[model samples]
Target chain A: MISVLLIGKGNIATHLFEAFSNLKEIKVTQINSRELDNIPNADITIIAVSDDAIAEVSNKINNNFVVHTSGSFAMTHLKNKTRKGVFYMLQTFTKNKKVDFSKVPFCLEAEDKNDYQLLEKLAKLLSEHNYNIDSEQRKRLHVAAVFVNNFTNHMYKIGNDICKENNIPFKILGPLIDETASKIKTLSPEKAQTGPAIRNDEETIKNHLNLLSENNKEIYKLLTKSIQNGN
Target chain B: MISVLLIGKGNIATHLFEAFSNLKEIKVTQINSRELDNIPNADITIIAVSDDAIAEVSNKINNNFVVHTSGSFAMTHLKNKTRKGVFYMLQTFTKNKKVDFSKVPFCLEAEDKNDYQLLEKLAKLLSEHNYNIDSEQRKRLHVAAVFVNNFTNHMYKIGNDICKENNIPFKILGPLIDETASKIKTLSPEKAQTGPAIRNDEETIKNHLNLLSENNKEIYKLLTKSIQNGN
Candidate 1:
């Protein structure tokens, strides 16, 4: 059985706490980051706080195994005198949205094989997807996450804005957005790509440019150039 | 019963033909865009040929009602001396992919009320999403589609490139990509935005910028600014 003391009351923390509570092999205790004076004894100490609070929170923990749930922060940065690791879930977390933990990719990092195996064992109990990713790789994965998640969401925002300006319902683009994401599962993004930018249809491209606002025109031109360069 | 003649053997033409062939109330005949000389006698003639070929294809058709499936092409451009309309389907059609016709937004336009009603009736037989979008609005929607579908797919391509470089299996990002698309269904993209860009986390943003290549850095910075500005 694994005894876990989970710290922080944030979105990730709350979700992790709920997930761990359901595992028969996991005896989990949750505490707010502010109430760190009395740190509970456990097989693992997980600090699921903000990126900035990770170091300070880890410094206060005196557990056998200490791990922070951060993508960018390295496991080596943990100030705990004992063993250090990372328990980063690579999916976004929201307070109200119920996450399907089984699909969430748990990116685990540890100093040694035994610690890595322990984290892997625990991760398997909650999810089928787990990776033994080190700090350097995790940092790169986080940047990639920014592109796929943050930047992609920005594209949707711009699409919504364009539709709104022209009195078109944004939801009309819903199926296309879903299919765009779904297409990558079977085909590589390079192969799945479509539209005038890739085809270099100058007439259609010219017409599209005239319809955009000044700010969007800058974005349209830049992305068009990038897609053409295939970078 | 409606008799329809579909021109062109392209992706959209093939998909529409397959769909229309199964309907009990419709008799659909598909011919190559090059075979416009033998004009088929049908109630509605749909020229699904290339944008450049729309005028030439419609010119050969003496059908009572004619339409072209080009998003940017105006309904009045069809040279069928009788009546003209547009049967624009605002979704990307790939050769191998099976499209859910019910979800495809059919943006129909016509010169008169009777022609509009006829196009609407045909659209309703196949899809639940039917919009009476004129030439100008259809043109705007097409641009918005470029943002949501084309530019967004580019983001996935870059994300895949970053993962491939770092030896991270791009499939690990599959769930995150799916979630990002699904989130916007319930929340507006403005409210759905997350990550360092939205938070204005300069430290994380700087780290991300440092990690990107020169070409990607340009895109990352521009998108970051756009998201920050809430555009």
Candidate 2:
């Protein structure tokens, strides 16, 4: 059985607490990041707090195994004398959204063999997608997440803005959005791409540019140039 | 029975012909655009050739009602002497990938009410998603599609490139990609936006820029600035 103590009341921590509590072989305890004075003992102590608070919070925890959930922060940042680790889930955790934990990739790290195995065992219980990613690799994944998740959503926002201005319903693009996301699984994004940029359809490109407002026009031009250069 | 003639055996025409031929109410005939000399007559003639060939192909069809399946081309561009219309499907059609007709948004346009009804009836026979979209709105939709589908996939390509360089399996980011696409279906992309750029976390942004290649660095900065300015 694994006893886990999670610190932080934010979205990531709350989601972790709930997920851990559901497993029969796990005993989970949660506490706010501010209330670290009387921190409970556990086999695994996870600090799922903000990036800025990670140092201060880890400095106070005296658990046998200390891990932070920050993608950017390294496991060595943990000030505890016993051991250090990282249990970063490589997916965004929203407050009310139901996360399919089975699909969430758990990027686990530890200094010693025993602690690494323990974390791996716990991760295996939650998800099949477990990677022994070190700090350097985690840093790469973090930035990639920004492009595929956050920046990709921004593209959708611009599309929505265009639809709104033209009195077209935004949902008309739902199937295309889903297809774009799923296509990468089978075909690499580089090969799956299709549009004016890739085809060099200058006439269509000019026509599309005339339809866009000032803000997206700048974006439209830059991305087009980038795609052309890369491809 | 409705006699439907489809010109051009490209991706869109092939898919449409397959869909129409499956229905018992529709008698569909497909011929290559090059074989236009022996043009068949039908109640509805669909010239699904390339955008450049749309005018020449439609000019040859002597059917009662004629439609071209080009999103950027206006319905009035069809030189059919009898009647002109459009049957634009707002989803990307790959050669081998199966298309879900029910989810495809059929943007139909016609010169008169009777022609519009006939197209609507045909669209309803194949799929539930039918709209009386004009040339102007379709032009808006075409540009919006470029943003949502084409540009968005480019972001995924950049992310994949980062993963390849770091030896991180690109599939590790698959769930995150699916979630990002699905999240926008419920929340507006404006509200759905997250990550360092939206939060104005300069430290994380700087770190992310350091990880990207020289090609994606410019893209990262531009998208980051755009997200900040818009949000």
What's candidate 2's DockQ score? Answer: 0.83
> What's chain A's TM-score in each predicted model?
0.97, 0.98
- Deviation (Å) of A221 in candidate 2: 1.1
Best by lDDT: 1
Per-residue lDDT of candidate 1, residues B1-231 (tens digit): 999999999999999999999999899999998876777799888899889899888888788999999988888888879888999998988887887899899999989899899988999999989998989888888888999999999999999999999899999999999999999999998998889999999999999899989999999999999999877
Query: What local distance difference test score does each model get?
Result: 0.91, 0.90
* TM-score of every prediction relative to native: 0.98, 0.98
Task: Quote the positional error of residue A32 for candidate 2 in Å.
Answer: 0.8
Candidate 1 DockQ category?
high
Best by DockQ: 1
DockQ for the candidates, in order: 0.88, 0.83
